[model samples]
Target: ITVEEGLEEEEITLPPLLIQPYVENAVIHGLAKKAGGGTVAVHFQRDNGALAVTVRDNGLGFRQEEGQAPSIRHSSVGMTITQKRLELLGSA
Candidate 1:
């Protein structure tokens, strides 16, 4: 759970607004797929002069357009929101 290095650190760049929703989706839908509990890891750093944040989980992966299990729809929303946010941020 690497969050902003510091709120006041001028060198820290905040990700575009939609990032939160994408993260929420990964936890809700992605990790939730695991039978037992799972770990969600997130990292933030400066990569090649650009900010890079990644969310990862150990859970069942999916294929394009594949319907998620019924219990997983709630989580998928987050990913969807994140994608939209990135698009709006012109980062897509």
Candidate 2:
């Protein structure tokens, strides 16, 4: 896991756990499946007036399971909940 911050001296605040699930997914689903392991790179930057975060992994990409619901497919429950929480806070 590597974190690269490009925010410089700017400071921003986000709701708790806004980014954890993605990182967790990258590690558990992405890197964990590879035989020799891989890297998870998290980049944070300030683009225009908004904060941008990018999580990249060299693991196998996602494939949807058959018979899964559209809303839940390819997404963990924690991610769904975090999205909802962000929506409620008007930050998503």
Candidate 3:
């Protein structure tokens, strides 16, 4: 796991847990199932007056599953919560 921060603004405030779910997803779902494991790269960039976070992993890409898996459900929960949080923050 590698974290790269390239923020144009030195000090920026962020809401709680805004970026953690994505980083966790990158590790848990993306890199954990690889043959010899893989790299999870997280980048934080400030663009204009907003923040852009990217979580990238070099691992096995998506494959078709027969049915809904537990991991899929877990991911959905995390993403759903994160999406709502983003919406709330945006409205604030």
Best by lDDT: 2
- lDDT tens string, model 2, 1-92? 33335555445577778889988887887777579999988777777777777888887666566443223346459878988998898878
Candidate 2, pairs of clashing residues: none
For 1-92, candidate 3 gives per-residue lDDT tens digits of 33335544455466788778877777777777778988878776666656667788886656566333234544257867888888877832
Worst 10 residues of 1 by lDDT: 69-78
Candidate 3 vs. true structure, TM-score: 0.69
> What are the lDDT scores of the predictions, listed in order?
0.65, 0.72, 0.67
Residue-level error in angstroms, candidate 3, position 1: 8.1
lDDT of 2 at 32: 73
Candidates 1 and 2 compared: the better one by lDDT is 2
Model 2 whole-model lDDT (C-alpha atoms): 0.72
Candidate 3 or 1, higher lDDT: 3
Give the residue spans of candidate 3 off by over 4 A: 1-9, 63-75
Model 2 has a clash total of 0
Instruction: Compute each candidate's TM-score over C-alphas.
Output: 0.59, 0.73, 0.69
Model 1 TM-score, all chains together: 0.59
